[model samples]
Target: MRASKNRSQKSEVRSQNPKTYEIHISGAEGVYEDAEILKIVKEYTNRALNHPKGKPDNIVITLEQIKQIPQKVPMLPVITLKCNSPDKAKEMIFQILSDIGVPARTIKNSFKILTSPRTMRGAAIILKESGVRVEPDRERGVRVSRLGIEKNTEKILVRKLSKMKVSITTVKEALILASKVAAYTDVIAEICISDDPDYTTGYIASKRLGYIRIPNIKSHGQNYGGRVFIVRENTNINRLIKYLEKTPIIISGDIN
Candidate 1:
């Protein structure tokens, strides 16, 4: 994995000011186990701390040590969200709508239980206790619908947002109405995710919506080099806006 380059690509996805970043678990691989590795690190640290001056035994690495590491966050990564299969699309839809600062409620996560009567009853009780409404269905174990979320729309440009935002995670089995919308992490407020200029729905949508900021893939030909689609120059954003307005496309999804 070109970790550096991959980070650049994901940065292009715009997000709302997401203070609560979800915890991500990346697999760890090593010849040593966790205990062994911890021991080695402790020893190395103690030696470095003492250096030329002899250090006391008490001044050693403690168990309560905190480590900070530099890393990258994915651009609106949806696959990482914690939700059941059926409610995944609802999660994405609501997240996208909310991020764009649209005041819309009642569009997320409903569960349809298909377990036996005993199991379903137990599940229903738990959900009800958690303040999630559940109703009995003759055909299904239990039926739950509609998720309500709080969205405060502060009229602002979609782009130029500088913090990690939680976006929708389109799952493999998700199907939105009549359209076969593919599951992807749709960047909050901004939706352009393709490197292909031919595919321009998101760009056009942003223009029409008056949210001028849009994402473009990093390209050397255009001299727009970065990991993701970021307008490095403030003036460059204006330049692109002009270029996109005059640029022509043969179809709705196509762009110059």
Candidate 2:
């Protein structure tokens, strides 16, 4: 009986085809980090293996280090997939890794992450597990989705803006002007104003114009000075132009 069992085990090991290949995933930071990649890999692997009844053979996997790459190429990291049948495993990996960027390839030891490069710090594993949607923040240098902003914007803005002086009058005026501009133009992101000492008045004017206040503006004095306000990229240029022309607040220098 013992001899027969040994033979059966050996035969199974030999007959079982192992799949080996690489899967490119988001890097170990930002939206998709190491933990997220690993979790997704494991899920795919299990699915590929079909949840075998008995102990499964160990499949060797390698993770490529995260790094920045050209904009034409993806910035995510590569995760190598190994199994008895590379082709089968590749298909499974593609099916399982949805929302996350996945590249196609043949039987290989390694793959590359072909998505936007992201910083791995503070990456939320829940997102990976749930496959949450993400939107790019091209202007702010961050990868934030609508859900992410909705969840944290109030808290974040309140804390950051609390220290800075905010005049209700100025804020109301900025909002009114900004609303008109937003309706007239294709601006999606809010207009940003600098808070330099000399530009305080301009900043206030911008606020009164109804533009969203961007945090971390250089400190400005209580009164408006000759500071230049920058209309952030991707904003409604027409609206901004109209506001500039219609608004009476001077950003060039202090009004005498």
Which parts of model 1 are misplaced by more than 4 Å? 1-79, 83-86, 105-188, 192-256
The TM-scores of all predictions, comma-separated, are 0.16, 0.20
Q: For model 2, what is the alpha-carbon lDDT of residue 228?
A: 17
Off by over 4 Å in 2: 1-165, 194-211, 221-256
Candidate 1 clash total?
A: 4
Query: Positional deviation of 185 in candidate 2, in angstroms?
Result: 4.1
Name the best candidate (by TM-score).
2
lDDT of 1 by residue, 125-226 (tens): 112112232223322212111111111111121121212241221110011100111111121122222212231112212221322212222221221110
Give the per-residue Cα lDDT of candidate 1 at 155: 12
Q: RMSDs, each prediction? A: 24.4, 25.3
lDDT of 2 by residue, 1-256 (tens): 0000012333455566634322211111112245576774665455334421222343333444434321111111112223334244334434433212222221011112111132111111111222222222221222111110111422443343444455532342333333332332332212223212333222212222333233223233321111112232344443444333333221111111
- Kindly give the stretch of ten consecutive residues in candidate 1 with the minimal lDDT sum: 172-181
In model 2, how large is the Cα lDDT of residue 46? 54
| Highest lDDT scorer | 2
